[model samples]
Target: MTILVMGATGAQGGAVARRLVAEGHSVRGFGRSGEVPAGVEPVTGPLEAALDGVSHVSLVLPMLLERAEVDRWVEIVAGSGVRRVVFNTANRIPPAATDVALFESRRAASDALLASGVPTVVLRPPVYLDNLRAPWVAGRLAAERVLSYPLPADLPVAWISHDDLAAATVAALTRDGLEDDVLDIGGPASLTGPQLAAAFGATYEAQDVAAFQEGLTHAFGPEVASVVAATYHWLAKHGGDLYETDPTAAERLGIRFTPVHEWIAA
Candidate 1:
């Protein structure tokens, strides 16, 4: 069976595509950049044509898609003969509506996909431990020996790795009886800022939320950055938990998570 992976050139999707390839599965990677894993067959032409003969899909949308764009994607996928879809929402879903554009847009997409007459599984992941390796954060950590983030000092986060998240996606795609389910996945342990910093033998600094937003604005445009930053800003004021300490759902699926220290060392 051929599995179609969207955004397979990006970090999360790249991990999924690589893992699937290593498992001897036939993988078709569709990405804007056209750079897929070594073994993946790149979908260079139309996506609709690429969906033909595909059995399952790993759907990873851009961080900021408009509601209409999300709907359009669901419409397209619904018509495809694919049997299953595993969508990575790429962030935490709020309990109630926080009115943050990014979160709400993703929520709407999840709802649309589940109701699109296709067997779909939505995976919501919390903050990624991989983010620490990004240039902006990594550079500072390397230079100053500090772990700075826009989270409260006491807030505990069960940071997940992209590879672990990829395993969950693969499980959701291959496993049965998970249709129309929304799962919140996380790492094994939830650590506070101090504890997380200690993993790298670095000092912890609570970065200002506004300053964090400004950094995002510089990297991503102001429009996307504003919406993305709004979630963190809301979290600062509302103090909603970003991760599940237990990760019971992941365990039930037989998905294993990498430890933070192990990831840091790697």
Candidate 2:
């Protein structure tokens, strides 16, 4: 089956496309920049043409998670013979009862999918272990053997990898009877900051929310830092273990999640 993958050049979308291709499926990408993974075809025309004989679609929206774009994409793919949609909300427990702008945007995106008349399966993945690969985060680990990030020390987070997310997404794309389902794509288990650091053979250094903002400012620019700092502050203050391992979902989806230690070792 041919799969139309939006954001196919991105980290998550690229991972999904590679997994699907490795499973012997045709993959097409609908992205503006960057190259799609080696075996995937890059779509360069209208959505109507792109959807011709397409079996499924995987969307990776921007951080803003605009609702209008969500509605627009779904509207085009609704009757285009696309059998399914696998949307990554980049959040584990979305639509939380909150006035936060990020949550509001993600909630709107999720609502748009449900209302768009498409057979959609939403995967809300929590904090990715891949975040450890970020330059700013990794630099600390490499230089001082310290894992420094914004999340509170006591917080237990279900850290997942983009690879695990890709596996789950591929299962969703090829399978059926998951029309309006929402799955929390978490890791094998939850880990605290120190526990996560211990996997890297590093010492855990919890950063102050303010210090995190400063570090982000130094790594990225002010505009990016301001937008990111809000979420970090929220996590440091109130973020809890919003999602846990759903073993039944994993078994049903035919996904074997990677644990933190396993990923670290690899």
Candidate 3:
């Protein structure tokens, strides 16, 4: 099967493309610069041109954009005879909180993909473990010796590793009989904000959530701050079940999901 991976320069797409190549499949990476791992074909063009000769596609587009772009991409891919797709969607976008732009955008994309007459599987991964490496945690670890972010201290989040998300995406792309499925993939263990802070304290100092957010705003700007705040509000009000794992996909793929700390250590 020939697979075309969108956003191949980004984390999830990059990992998925690499894994597919390692498995000896014909993989083509589509992105702005066509920067892909060695041994993979790089296609530089818009989504329409990239859809040619592609039997399957893995979409990892940005989550904060206008929904129309996603719809258009899906239309192009479907029109081009792409039969299967694996969408990296956001788990936090519940029907009740459709007002959040990021979540709404991802939800729109998922809907578009499903309605595009193509077999599709959507993987909704939770907060990534690598998100901790953002300047919010890095600065906190450097100065205050702590890791903090907005959210109730006791709110538990099922943070999945990006590597695991990639693995799940690969499984969805390569496996059969999983079309039109939506799977929430997360880590084996869930940790509360305070619990995660304590875990970080084992290796670095523990800082307050306010300080972390403040540093994050400085590092990432106000738009990111608003998104983070909205995400924390969703977690606090609706809880972390948004990103909860079902284990079916992992079991079917025969790959154990990586734990949060284990990924962090790596």
Across residues 158-230, which tens digit of lDDT does each residue of candidate 2 receive? 8899899899899888776778888877887878889888889888877888887887789787866777777
Worst 10 residues of 1 by lDDT: 238-247
Q: After superposition, how far is residue 167 of candidate 1 from its true place, in Å?
A: 1.0
- Can you tell me which runs of candidate 2 are displaced by over 4 Å? 44-49, 64-67, 79-81
Give the local distance difference test score of model 3.
0.73
TM-score, predicted candidate 1 vs. hidden true structure: 0.94
230-265: candidate 1 lDDT, tens digit per residue:
878877777656665656767656778888988877
Give one digit per residue, the lDDT tens place, for model 3 in 169-188: 88888787889987777777
Task: Give the best candidate by TM-score.
Answer: 1
> Distance (Å) between predicted and true CA of 111, model 2?
2.2
For candidate 2, the 10 contiguous residues with the lowest summed lDDT are: 92-101
Q: Candidate 1 or 2, higher TM-score?
A: 1
lDDT, residue 164, candidate 2? 91
- Clashing residue pairs, candidate 1? none
Q: What residue runs in model 3 are displaced by over 4 Å at the alpha carbon?
A: 95-97, 142-145, 201-217, 220-229
Clashes of 2: 0
Clashes of 1: 0
